[model samples]
Target chain A: MAELLVYLAATLVGVAFLLALYRFFKGPSSADRVVAFDVLTIVSVTAIALVALAEGRGIYLDVALIYALLSFLGVIVVARYLERGL
Target chain B: MDIVGGLLLVGGAAFLLFGGLGLVRMPDVFNRIQAGTKATTLGTLLGLAGIACLQPDWALKLFLIGLFILFTNPISSQVLARAAHRSGARKSALTAVDRLEEDHGA
Candidate 1:
């Protein structure tokens, strides 16, 4: 049951990732692409969590944590650049 | 317990999918950020909760992850919106308010 759930969630998130990728590429403005990128990272973190459960591994949770932090930093830096400031 | 966890996982994934749909469909950057941040944050919390349920021993760490998400999602979205506005991304024509503009001349 748990495995089935993990698979289902991962599949759904994969679909979400595709949609986000489309927006990232098709967005009219830089901000639009940045927002799409942010959504993609969030979806990836969720994916990591689901995969960790499916594989019965604890180490992947740490990966999720680090990924989340780095994504936050990336978004902030891009936003700052968009604002034409440091 | 497993069944409950599975349900949470499915529901969270559904929310996540909706967020992505909103990102594609929303008319403007602000609306897109609104949809993306709210839906994804809730979805992520639910997904983390489901994992906690499935792995009782990892509950504390999962909780911390969820907490981090809750705090950061809104902050990032807010900063993005502010930067978008500062960079002159126009709002949708249908938008009702310009208070932020009137107040700060943004």
Candidate 2:
């Protein structure tokens, strides 16, 4: 049952990734792309967590945390540059 | 327990899908960020919680991951919105006011 749930969640997140990719490439403004990228990273972290659950591993949780931190930094840096504040 | 965890996982994924939809369909950068941030934050948290339920021993790390996400997601979105506004990203026609502009002028 849990395995089935994992597969379902994976499918949903995969669809979300595709939609986010479209926005990332097609957004009119750089900010829109950045927002799409941010959504993508969040979805990725969720995927990583799901993987951890399915594999019964704890290290992947650490990977998710690091990914979250890195993405946050990336967005902040890009945002600062956009505002000419960096 | 498995059933509840599964429900949470599915619900999170659904929210994530809506967030992506909002990103693609929202009228302006700010609206897109708002929708994406709120929905994805909740979705990621739900996913993490579900993972915690599936693995009782790893709950502490999962909790920390969720906490970090909850704290950072809004801050990043706020930065993005501020940057977009300052960089002159176009606003939707339906936008009512420009508080930032007024503040800058004052």
Candidate 3:
């Protein structure tokens, strides 16, 4: 039953990731693209965490944390670059 | 592990799907941020809580992720919004209620 929940979560999040990717590719404005990127990051982290559960491993939590940090860094970098006056 | 957790997991997934759909359908960047932050935050909280419910021993780690996400998601959204404003991403065609452009008008 637990594994079933994990699989369901993963599938739904995978679909969400696909949607984020669609927005990332189709967004007309730079800010739109940036938001899409941020959504993608969040989805990816969620996916990793779900995978961790299915695997019954604690290590994937560390991976999810790392992913979270990296995504934050990516947002900061992209935000700074797009700020135009920086 | 139990039905409660499963419900949370399913609910979270549904919230995520909504966020993604909203992102594509929203009118502007600001609207996008609003949808993205609220849905993702709730979805993530539900997802992590479900997992924590299953593994009682590692609840600490799961809770940590949830807390970290709660702390950071809003902060990053604020940063992004500020950057967008300071970078002049707003449209001149927008209504006059924008606080970010109040003093910058010609």
Candidate 4:
């Protein structure tokens, strides 16, 4: 059952990644692409968590945390540049 | 608790799917972000909680991940909205009400 859940999560997140890629490439504006990219980062973190669950490992949680922080900072930095015209 | 956790997971995934659908079908950028953020945040949290249900040892870390996501998703959305505003992406004409920009100009 756990294995099933893990695989399901992986598949879902993988599809999410694909959708995000479409947005990244087809975004009408820079903000659109950045937002899509941020979401892709989130989806990737979730995908890693699912992988950890499948493997029954605990270390991936830490990786998720770090990814969250890095994506947060990246999105903020990019938004700042776009907003302030810097 | 197992059943409840499973339910939460299902519900979360439903909302997540709805958000993604909204992203694809929404008329404009701001609407897409609004739809995407709320749904995905809740969806991901519930899904993570479901996984935590299976692994009691990882529950704390799961909560931490969820907390970080809750904090960041809205913050990032705000940043995106700011960028959109600066770039002059108009809200959908159907929105009918928005106070932030009104306050901004006042």
Q: Highest DockQ, which number?
A: 2
lDDT of 1 at A32: 98
* lDDT by residue for model 1 (B1-106), tens: 9878877888899899999999999999999999999999999999888888888888898888899989999999999999999898979999998888898888
Candidate 2 chain A: worst-modelled 10 consecutive residues by lDDT: A49-58
Question: Residue by residue across A1-86, what tens digits does model 2's lDDT show?
Answer: 88788789889999988999999999889999999999999999999988887787888888999999999999999999998966
TM-score attained by model 4: 0.86
Summarize candidate 2's per-residue lDDT along B29-96 as a digit string, tens digits. Answer: 99999989999999998987877777778888888989999999999999999899988999999999
Q: What is the DockQ (computed on Cα atoms) for candidate 2? A: 0.87
In model 1, how large is the Cα lDDT of residue B84? 97
Residue B11 CA displacement from its true place in model 1, Å? 0.9
Candidate 4 docking: what grade? acceptable
> How far off is residue A67 in model 1, in Å?
0.6
CA lDDT, candidate 2, residue A71: 99
DockQ of 3: 0.68
lDDT of 2 at A80: 97
Tens-digit lDDT string for candidate 3 (B1-106): 5777877887888788888988887777877888998899899889888877876766798788888888888888888877777776755355457765777741
- Model 1, chain A: how large is the TM-score? 0.90
Model 4, position B13, has a per-residue lDDT of 58
lDDT of 4 by residue, B1-106 (tens): 6555555555555556666666666777888888778877887898788778877799999999999999999999998887887667756689787686777741
- Estimate TM-scores for all models: 0.96, 0.95, 0.90, 0.86
